[model samples]
Target: MSNTRPSLTLTLLQAREAAMAFFRPLLNQHGLTEQQWRIVRILRQQGELESHQLARQACILKPSMTGVLGRLERDGLVRRWKSPQDQRRVYVNLTEKGQQCFVSMSDGMESNYQKIQAQFGEEKLQQLLGLLNELKQVKP
Candidate 1:
């Protein structure tokens, strides 16, 4: 048998899963999927954005985004409206309920993050984040 290197893609996926494990329970408790949580988080930080921009920032495909947004809108956690300037474009923003939901979850999220930093070591986690950001810049 020969020594073989692990696949980078697999390693990254594993790391993501491991990291998400910490936050998954919190998200589940709030009845949110990862994609849904991502959109909520982005909207909270970015204010109103076009549907396309939200899809891009959330790394969600346009087709899937429609359903996700539909559900969010249906739940009254978010609101969407056709752009006044461009009927073809739609804008999305969190409703007051959505803001409350985020506020409710933030403390748990922050606690989990602090736990990760403590267990992983703040310096190591920072270094890992820096490396990951650098890797994201690499173009294939």
Candidate 2:
């Protein structure tokens, strides 16, 4: 049989799964799904953002984000309001509870990150992040 080339998409997915394995338990323990965690993380870093902006930054679709935001709101982890300047736009921000959750989990997350970094080597991990960020800017 002829040799086949390695697939970039598959390799990237494998890397993501490997990374997620380290943090999934932490997320599960906190009663958060991956998508919910992403939303919280983004909101913690970015403060208030329009729903569309949150969806874009979190890499979640608007439709999925609607349901995720609803659940987050119901859990008291997030709050949303219609924009005063534009009634059609909805903005989302984390509540104090969400901030506390992030703060509480950040140490463990950082520890897991350090463990992953140690396993991957700091320089290689930095290079991988740089490459991935560069890939984000590339237009199809």
Candidate 3:
């Protein structure tokens, strides 16, 4: 007989996947892909970042960012220009249109966040968030 331990970690992963599946489709309705929405959310928080930095924060590869940036640039949601000091490096910032989108997305995200809080009480959510953050800590 195989010894099987019940795992909260596995359950959490499944719940996260299900939640993302539901939330992501709502953003898609606004003509934004999951990756694009992530970029918008990150920019809303960080103000501005180098294109490479945005890619890192989004947990996407640099190559994938090239296309995402290209699409966002074409949509006029993001503006990218070479850094004044180093022309080789490009910086990305949200345009007014991008900010509007960010605001809407943030509202939706916050609503979903509240639902999560309601599903699991504040204290449990806080504990889960702390545990998740601890799991996400950078390793040297």
Best by lDDT: 1
Structure candidate 3, residue pairs in collision: none
How many clashes in each candidate? 0, 0, 0
Query: What lDDT tens digits, residue by residue, belong to model 2 across residues 1-140?
Result: 98999998999999999999999999999999999999999999999999999999999999999999999999999999997888999999999999999999999999999999999999999999999999999998
Looking at model 2, the pairs that clash are none
Q: What is the lDDT of residue 121 in candidate 2?
A: 96
What TM-score against the true fold does each predicted structure earn?
0.94, 0.95, 0.84
What is the Cα-based lDDT of residue 25 in candidate 2? 98
Cα distance off (Å), candidate 1, residue 94: 0.6
User: 25-72, model 3: which lDDT tens digit per residue?
Assistant: 678778998899989889988988998889999988999999998999
Error of 1 at 31 (Å): 0.7
lDDT of each: 0.97, 0.96, 0.87
Residue 73 of model 3: what lDDT? Answer: 92
Question: Which ranges in model 1 have alpha carbons more than 4 Å from their true place?
Answer: 1-4
Give the RMSD in angstroms, all C-alphas superposed, for model 2: 1.2
- How would the candidate models be sorted by TM-score, starting from the highest? 2, 1, 3
- Alpha-carbon RMSD of each model: 1.3, 1.2, 2.6
